[model samples]
Target: MMQATQKQDFTTTFSVDRNPREAFEAITNVRGWWSQEVEGVTDQVGGEFDHHYKDVHRCRIRVTELVPGRKVAWLVLDNFFNFIEDQAEWKGTEVVFEISEKDGGAEVRFTHVGLVPQYECYDVCTNAWNGYLGGSLRNLINTGQGQPNPKEGGNAPAHQDAATVLRARRTP
Candidate 1:
């Protein structure tokens, strides 16, 4: 029997007292909210950056679209999630942030394209993103400095290769 596949992407929207430009700037500052371990440029189109979350997650993303005070999009070039069955599940995803003026403030919408519910990491990833976007990122837009994840270094043991952690997951 053929079953219909459902499409589900994580999205969150909120309005802030700041202007669209401020919201845009905050979204571009990936390290400020998403991760402190980001490397490379993230503010310009075609620029690339790497985000590492301890040893559990790592991804290289390129800024594919950036419209000042309006929209920004990132293409995930490569990814590895140690806890997931498909370590490279997020490799081709797109993370998008759109900002618009509304009610004398800025309305920000964030979407993680391809992060469907069928993916193994969807629940955990979505919850983490809620804290990052709704809580941390929003705090940065309202006040200075976001509550980013602590720099706790890598989680893999010193004797093990980081890539090996992905292969060590139990088979279903």
Candidate 2:
């Protein structure tokens, strides 16, 4: 059996026992599940936001698409990762969230549109996204409380799932 191997973007999906509107709202609440410091606008189209996690990873995201109860997309304008050699690996990528009605509830699909396995950040990033989407984000939609990184001094490095990435990399 010849198995075809092809690289694909990183993506994850989860179902919530809520309406599409609720799921969409939870997805827009970036500060809720992503667990970082966000500045500027996140829910408005054409808006820009910057999120940083203890100098480990920082990115400027511009909201390129916002569809109520349907979808939201953000384009990565700039990115910095202290762990990987290519600090700009996330630049020019797109973070997209799609919400659709399913089984009397809603399903949210998250896709990091250019984050292929070829990038160094793929493994660590995939783990983080899985935690964010499957655990935190899903909790927020269901219970109204997402375990976000608080502003107070706790949870060092901010990114709950990716803190080790910083210490694992060598500083040149």
Identify the candidate with maximal TM-score.
2
Instruction: Show the colliding residue pairs in model 1.
Output: none
Cα deviation of 115 in candidate 2 (Å)?
Answer: 0.3
Residue-wise C-alpha lDDT for candidate 1, range 6-96, written one tens digit per residue: 6767788999888999999999988787777889999989999988876678899999999999999999999988777787679898988
lDDT against the true structure, each candidate? 0.80, 0.82
What are the candidates' C-alpha RMSDs?
6.6, 4.3
TM-score of each: 0.84, 0.89
**Model 2, range 1-172, lDDT digits (tens) per residue?**
1122265888888899999999989888999877558888999999999887766678899999988999999999999876788877799988888899999999998889889999988887887778778888899999998876666476643335464744555544
**Candidate 2's C-alpha lDDT?**
0.82
Off by over 4 Å in 1: 1-6, 153-172
Candidate 1, run of 10 with poorest lDDT:
154-163
Deviation in Å, model 1, residue 156 alpha carbon: 16
Q: Which pairs in model 2 have colliding backbones?
A: none
